[model samples]
Target chain A: MRETPSLIVRYVARRAVPFIQLYALYVLGHGEDGPGGGFQGGVIFASSFVLLALAYGWGQGRKHVPEKLFDLLAPAGCLLYAGIGFVALLVGGAFLQYEAFVGEGADHATKHHAHHFGLIGIELGVMLTVTASMVILFFEMSRPDEEGAFGDGASQEDVEALHDGSAATEEAPDA
Target chain B: MEVLILAILVGLAVAAVRARDLMASVAILGGYSLMMALLWCQMNALDVGFTEAAVGAGISTVLMLAALGRIGRREVGPTRAPLLRLPLLTMQQRLRRARHLSRQHHRSSAWGAILVCVLVGGALLYGTRDIPQVGASDSPANRAGSLAEYYVTKAPEEVGPANMVTSVLGDYRGYDTMGETVVIFTAALCVLMLLRQARVRRGDERDA
Candidate 1:
């Protein structure tokens, strides 16, 4: 990795990252947002994490967005999405029926508000899941210790065995 | 203006193909994507342009470079190409490298596959040329009684979001968006399941 691990680069990254993350949040919240949402914002958010990983190695990188949290958040985003749909179902409407959230005979404005809320909720779910997933994929691929450990168990062991026989015990030897 | 950008894109594409260095090719590919994104923006598709800029120019280039670190960096070149002397010093060494690449991938097969891809892509582009101009108000896509018309007219009152796209995606076509979220979630789960094997094995060892 061609890492420019200097204070100046890190400082610039540190200063710029907050705005990147905030812009990602804006993309996530599309109620009155500018163009681009969910997927774009999620990738942007994930990039911030990836940048930290690259600048400071995955060791410090993993700390910024803990591995365990990423693991949970990835799936949780999808569950949140399904749960919202289930809520709509419980409200006596068809699946994903935001109109049902507004009481029957409610004013048009109320319906509009309900729809807006539902859309924002699901978009948030997308953002969370996408961001977490992208970061996870990045971490998995970028891990210095774990080359060719991406597939099933058998292949991973074969790769490890091959590495052990040929090269130095190079990849995160202690860890 | 569009023609100028397209001409630059064509030049970039040719340069990307001719660039012997894997990393250089990837960089040129990034430049091509930027031009494409610019074209999208010029055509007033800000949302599509934003996505292209973010994904194409941002994470993809970084990821490709990172991947290049794992897989070999400089592509193996043939002996006849004296220009490749930077990496291949001797004829024997270049031939050996050429044989290695041929073993993995036949050069002719690669060219044939690329030709097929270009042919199919051209055909598809030609087929789609007759479709009404993108976002044209009077196009059949936006005519009354169509779903697009319904969303545009009724989305605000019914779905509530001022944006028709969001309303259709999150409210009208809510199930699809939910599924999309689940798919993204599942992607994370799959990565964890596959990549976190060491932790899982440790748990199993303790149980055993």
Candidate 2:
């Protein structure tokens, strides 16, 4: 939080985050053709948010993504991934079977299209899970704690207590 | 070209290891990862290269820098010569006064870490001798009976993937990728539990 006091860093990060977030979406959506994938795109997405925190501190970051929402987002991503696979099982096919999604696709081209569609479904799941996880990890590690216990946030009381503890330690040398 | 890249890799690795400042070391590690990403690109593994550049060089570097904030930047000096050295940096001294730290030093621990690094590096170098030749058509990895041939020939016709890696990752090994997503979710949950703050505010009887 102390490291994020620079005006230029906040300015640059604010300007750059939108573009980074946009690229993350592009990478996730157009992943089938390029060097992008769900995991790669997700991490990139998370880093954009992480930049917000690193540049402007947890106060601004928390405003952008509430801590409670982030806690739910991570597990929701994983569940989305598993839900797609479960659909196949419910449709009388082996788990994660793409051919099961083909309802009227009687030909090879149609079948191929179905597989492509299925791949996109899982990719979305991966993107969500990875993005949520990376964001959560960043938020967790970068949190400034009160009692040196790596807590969620630092309160005024914690700061005062910290000062008191330091003062006590300082005076002990003479006593 | 490979030799040049390898030389750069070696140099970066050494630089990363020898760097005294934790922040500087993290920056060097990021550079090293970028080099590895370039090497992967040269080898035509674009997806792997992209992931390496994004995750290892980008996010991991940021994460290291963030984590470094919790701990001391300076490695406590083990040499007795610097024991009495009280740096007279006025600005820094004021900053240090504001932030309290408890430092401990062990020269043997540093030596042990160096020894471990040497052993690991040596073992890796030794293991490289047994590796099959790169890009060899006759090598076990690329032989006629190998799985690579099947994936190359059959994937397009059967799986209909624009990218073979996707075909393999999402279809042939769909379970594996899904498992990876679950792992990511689990990690998120663990971090959440660890970092979540639970506090109970007490009614002040002292004020009354």
Candidate 1 stretches greater than 4 Å from native: A1-4, A31-33, A146-175, B77-129, B135-139, B198-208
Which tens-of-lDDT digit does each residue in B33-136 have in candidate 2?
99999999999999999999999999989877667655644445532211112353367764664343323435577679899999999999999998888888
For each candidate in turn, the TM-score is: 0.76, 0.78
Clashing pairs in 2: none
In candidate 1, position A35 carries an lDDT of 75
Clashing pairs in 1: none
Off by over 4 Å in 2: A1-7, A103-105, A147-175, B77-126, B197-208
Model 1 agreement with the true structure over B1-208: per-residue lDDT tens digits: 9999999999999878766566778899899889989999999777778889988988788777656655644566552232323363467876776787677777899889999999999999999988897778879888768888777788666666555666666677778877877776776677677756865686689799
DockQ of 2: 0.37
Q: What is the C-alpha RMSD of each candidate to the true structure, in Å?
A: 8.6, 8.8
